[model samples]
Target: MQDITVISMIFTTILALACLFLILSPLFKWDTYIQVSSKGKDINATKEALLTTLNEIEFEFKMDKISHADYKHLKKQYETEVASIMKEEEELMITNIDRELKDEVEKEIEAQMKTYKNKKGEGK
Candidate 1:
């Protein structure tokens, strides 16, 4: 009877701990591979998925499930998709950097113009 009681207590403790972890799970964040932007993340995920699928198709061709001609076609399509996604990501990064630099330059130019105007007014 004591053994049963001990087992029940242990089970209850484990259940409580599990509930606690579940409740706190959202509070503890871990590094995630998922991108924050849906468009970017979906594009990246599609690229990765295509790469894996291309590899699998190659394997299937070797196993006689897919013919060489069909494999070539499928591989080309996947490669094109991955390439397009990579290009988009690259362009997005370049545009973002350019925008940041442009903003910084504009701010500096404004500050310099203000200083020049102030100096001219003081000299007059």
Candidate 2:
């Protein structure tokens, strides 16, 4: 029927656009797609997203949906991205831990100073 043909064409166009968006999304880094999710916008989240995308690409390749060249290119790009994301996360975690330790040490020193002052007063 004419109606069925029209609907099928519309569906095909939508599917093609979705594929294009998926292909271009990594290059452009769609902010909303990656940021506004439940996982959050941290380095870990970004790495997870990249991993998921990489897995999807692998699955698609296995299913014969994508060409070998495209699969190879996308896989390499995603792996590089994931490595950088994890490296940044590791550095950030180290900095946070260092800052927390310094704060705790300062607090302990202040408490010790107060105790020393109290002891002096008692001796006098």
* Tens-digit lDDT string for candidate 2 (1-124): 9999999999999999999999887888576665656432566667888999999999999999999999999999999999888877778779999999999999999999999999999999
**Model 2: colliding residue pairs:** none
Please report the candidate that would top TM-score against the real structure. Answer: 2
Model 1: residues with Cα > 4 Å off, grouped in runs: 1-37
TM-score of model 2 relative to the true fold? Answer: 0.60
Q: Cα deviation of 77 in candidate 1 (Å)?
A: 1.3
Query: Mind giving the per-residue lDDT tens digits that candidate 1 earns over 1-124?
Result: 9999999999999999999999998886533533454667777778889889989998999999988899999989988988988899899899999999999999999999999999999999
In model 2, the Cα lDDT at residue 58 comes to 99
